[model samples]
Target chain A: DQQVKQNSPSLSVQEGRISILNCDYTNSMFDYFLWYKKYPAEGPTFLISISSIKDKNEDGRFTVFLNKSAKHLSLHIVPSQPGDSAVYFCAACLYNTDKLIFGTGTRLQVFP
Target chain B: GAGVSQSPSNKVTEKGKDVELRCDPISGHTALYWYRQRLGQGLEFLIYFQGNSAPDKSGLPSDRFSAERTGESVSTLTIQRTQQEDSAVYLCASSPPGIGNQPQHFGDGTRLSIL
Candidate 1:
């Protein structure tokens, strides 16, 4: 069973535009959500995260918005650059579980 | 301060062979994790280790898959008699103690291919 799901397999956007990636979760117990960006042959790098207590969190050009009632969250990258082209993975973790459940990931391509 | 490191970036072996993948976590990090990503799939949790405590191996696929950690620094994942289905990129991650809410730092991962 996929606890977390990223419906979009891929996305393309022009440079300097806003890029949005969405994710959904089946487990309401998850209290923390995170986004990671990965390049080819490289490990995923931490991007942004949001706690259940907060509905939104922003880090520089990256912003994460969470909707608890809908069991959904999204990552928005403003002024997307060519370097922003990578796979974005959404992950969730419950309070007690030390492991994080990851989604299938969305491949983002930014055209310069 | 270096990040997590994984060795043997790529390994190709015939079916029924055994392969060992290694990982070195960040300095002083007490938590380590292992995950597998099959092509065109999501990351699947395999195991977790926390400073001198028993590991959580609930996600291990089968008995043929096992792991070991030396202290809080290094870890090794061993796949015995590997099958074609075992081919995937094995990733390792680490975090500091009391930082479960924080994001994990990942290694480049070891890509294993069973031919």
Candidate 2:
């Protein structure tokens, strides 16, 4: 069973615009959520993360909002650049657990 | 030069053959993990190793699949008598020696294709 799901397979947005990618989870036990960006033939790089207790976390141009009651979270990239085009994966893990559950990933294309 | 490294970026082999994929994690990192992504699917956890402790083999799909790590360094994933369904990109990740909440660094991964 898929505990974490990113229903959107692809997204496109103009450069300098805000790009939003959404993710949903079925398990309520998940306490920590993270986002990773991956380029073609490259491994995923850590982006932003949020804890279950908080509703939002921001770092520079990337922000992650979490809604515990809804079992959902999203990543927003403001002023998106062409380099932001990549597959974004959302992952979750139970408190104190190292193994992460990942989503199917959303491919975002930022064009100028 | 300090990130996780995986060898043989791409490998193509016939069915019923055995293939070994290698991963060298970041230096001094005590935690290592293996995951795979099949076509149109999410990353699936395969195994985990931490320091000198016993590795977590819960995610291993079958007896034909096995992984080994020496000390806290290089890891090898061996698929015996590989099947067509075994084709996928196997990814390796590592983290520092601390709480599991830390983010993991990953390698480029080894893409294995069974012909």
Candidate 3:
């Protein structure tokens, strides 16, 4: 079973526009969530993360919102740039656990 | 290397042949993990090793799949009598020792193709 799900397979947005990606989880035990961005041949790199206790976390142009009640979280990239185009995977893990459950990933295309 | 290192970036072997993939995690990292990503699919957890603790092998899909890590260093994942379905990108990741929430640093991954 897929504990973490990213329903959107792909997304497209114009440069300098807002891009939002969504993810949902089935397990409430997951207390920490993270987002990773990946290019075609490289491994995924960490982007942003948020604890379940907080509703939002922001870093520069990227922001993550968490809603514990709905078991949902989202990553928002404001003023998206061409460099931001990549596959985004949402991951979640339980407190003290070493394994991270990952979503299928959503490919975001930011065009000029 | 500054990042996790995986050897033999691409492998193409005939079916039924055994293949071994290797990973070198970042120095000083104590947590290592293995994952597989098939075309059009997300990363699937395969195994994990933390310090001297027993490895978690629950995610291994079959008895033909096995992995070994020596003293928090290099790891090897071996697949015996590979099948076409086994073809995919196998990724290795390492994380600093922590209770949780540490983002894993991953290698580019070893792409295996069973023909």
TM-score between candidate 2 and the true structure: 0.98
Overlapping backbone residue pairs in candidate 3 total 0
How well does candidate 2 score on lDDT at residue A73?
100
* Most accurate candidate by DockQ: 1
lDDT of 1 at B69: 98
User: Can you write out model 1's per-residue Cα lDDT over B69-102, one digit (the tens) per residue?
Assistant: 9999889999999999999999999998784486
lDDT of predicted model 1: 0.95
Error at B103, model 1, angstroms: 1.0
Please report, as a residue range, the 10-residue window in candidate 2 chain B with the lowest summed lDDT: B95-104
lDDT of 1 by residue, A1-109 (tens): 8999999999999999999999999999999999999998999999999999999999999999999999999999999999999999999998777789999999999
Q: DockQ of each candidate's interface versus the true one? A: 0.92, 0.89, 0.88
Interface RMSD (Å) of candidate 2:
0.6
Per-model TM values vs. the true structure: 0.98, 0.98, 0.98
The DockQ-derived docking category for candidate 2 is high
TM-score (chain B) for candidate 2 is 0.97
Fraction of reference contacts reproduced per prediction?
A: 0.90, 0.88, 0.80
